[model samples]
Target chain A: MRVLGVDPGLTRCGVGVVEGVAGRPLTMIGVGVVRTPADADLGHRLVAVEQGIEQWLDEHRPEFVAVERVFSQHNVRTVMGTAQASAVAMLCAARRGIPVALHTPSEVKAAVTGSGRADKAQVGAMVTRLLRLSAPPKPADAADALALAICHIWRAPAQNRLQQAVALHTAKAPKGRTA
Target chain B: MRVLGVDPGLTRCGVGVVEGVAGRPLTMIGVGVVRTPADADLGHRLVAVEQGIEQWLDEHRPEFVAVERVFSQHNVRTVMGTAQASAVAMLCAARRGIPVALHTPSEVKAAVTGSGRADKAQVGAMVTRLLRLSAPPKPADAADALALAICHIWRAPAQNRLQQAVALHTAKAPKGRTA
Candidate 1:
């Protein structure tokens, strides 16, 4: 499966594409950041983000788009920008019927580093090793983007199994029972 | 001047259009709410908002788009949705090259009711009076949207004069001298 991961931010939105399935070696297709000027008006900044994400979608056309889920508990100012950027990324994907998945920061870290509380350097190092790159993607955000894609690629299989189990159980059970 | 006002929300997005200048009586061209199912996914919700805002833009052809400024200090979950919805509204306007303006709730209230802390009912009443409508717009969000457009219409003149004053002073000052 091919997936695009987005670490959303207004100033620097990180995007990366990974191709592979669970229990197999994954390949990094592309990774980069979309930067918007700080001085630009909010409307124009959002437009820039939309354009950048659209360009990525056109170039890669991944089957799924994974966005870093935003939590309002973070720095109040930064969280708003993150939410806005993520919305743009999700919108771009959904407009084209690409499935969008959301992964929390801890989920991405835990998937790659075996610990939910892993530091940035540790996450970066793990991404470099997993992707077999000469070095970690620059700007930390890029590394996080790769981590998100890797996490989604690894977790999806297990999730699908759970979903299938539930479906089968539901079908075999007595009728007229509500969830 | 024609202005479209947007009060952004995930479940119910309010939109209104007003036409007139700062001093003269304003006309309420249109007012309504765009609703998305609460169970809908985030990306689809945003797409719905974009389509709704775009339809308003096409029908009204407003010169300016005024959206309520989202603050992260509000209900955490609700605030994130508001920020996301507002981003989509701004994106729709900016993509079309229409000037976008953000008005705070306090500013909208102050512009209409002469008090920044005015209650929603007061603001709604004033909007009705200003627009010479027989009744206030239904759903507080709709009223708030009209208030936003009215606020933008009334404030733009003063803001313009302030800009002109600063430009004039700069032109009269010595050149090549840093402040």
Candidate 2:
């Protein structure tokens, strides 16, 4: 499967595409960052992000999109901007009927480096080795994006099976009872 | 000016439109909520929100769009969902070139009832009176959406002047030099 991973941010969003499957070697299709000036209006910045993502989607045409889920952050402003960028990424994928997955930072770290507590450099090193690249992707966000794609590519099949199991169980569940 | 106000949420997003100028009576053009099932996938839910906002923009064609600025919340997940929804609202407006403004909850309360700490009922009552409606809009989100529009309509002119003043000052400032 070809997965496009997005590390969503307002000023700099990372985009990377990887083609791979579980228990197999992966190939790097593309990697880049979409940047908007800090001084730009919020709407204009968002427009630029939307356009950038659209361009990437058009060119790479990944079957799956992985986005870094915005979790708790001490800086609410930063978190809000990240969440906004994430939603845009999801919307872009949804509009194209591409399946999207959200992976937590820890999940990506653990999947890429075999440790949830792995630092940026460790994850970068692992991603470089996994993709057989001579050097790590520039800018931490780019490496992180590739990690997200790798995580989803590795995790999606198991997740789908779990979901199917849950659905089947629910289908067999008893009817609601009143007190 | 005609303003479309959005109170963004993951499950139920409140949308309202009003037309008026500062120091003049306001008219309510539309009010409703866009709802998504909780069990739906995040990407699908976000797409629903985008479509809902796009439909509103097409139908009402408001000159300006006002979105509730999400603030820090104790629940990180709730805050993230809200921020995501808010981004979709902004994207809809930005795509249409409709000027967008974000109003904080306190700002909306202050604009409607002359008190930043005004309770919801008080704001609802004020919105009812301002709009010449017999009853407050159903669902607190709906009322809050109207309040956002009212706040923006009253504040935009002054805000524009302040922005212009800052722009002028920066433009006339001395060039780079050692202090």
Q: Which candidate is the best by lDDT?
A: 1
> Clashes in candidate 1: how many?
0
- Candidate 1 error regions (>4 Å): A158-179, B158-179
| lDDT scores of the candidates, listed in order | 0.83, 0.82
TM-score: model 2, chain A: 0.88
DockQ (model 2, Cα): 0.24
Per-residue CA lDDT of model 1 for A72-160, tens digit only, reads 99998798889999999988887776767899999999999999999999999999999999999988988999999999999867664
Query: For each candidate, what is chain B's TM-score?
Result: 0.88, 0.87
lDDT of 1 by residue, B1-179 (tens): 89899999988888999999977878999999988778666777777788788888888898888999998888986998999999999888877767778899999999999999999899989999999999989899999999999999899676645533443443222111100
Each predicted complex: what DockQ? 0.22, 0.24
Chain A TM-scores, all candidates? 0.88, 0.88
lDDT of 2 by residue, B107-163 (tens): 999999999999999999999999999899988888999999999889968774564
The lDDT, on a scale of 0 to 1, for candidate 1 is 0.83
TM-score of chain A of 1: 0.88
Q: Candidate 2 i-RMS (Å)?
A: 11.4
Per-residue error at B140 for model 1, in Å?
Answer: 0.7
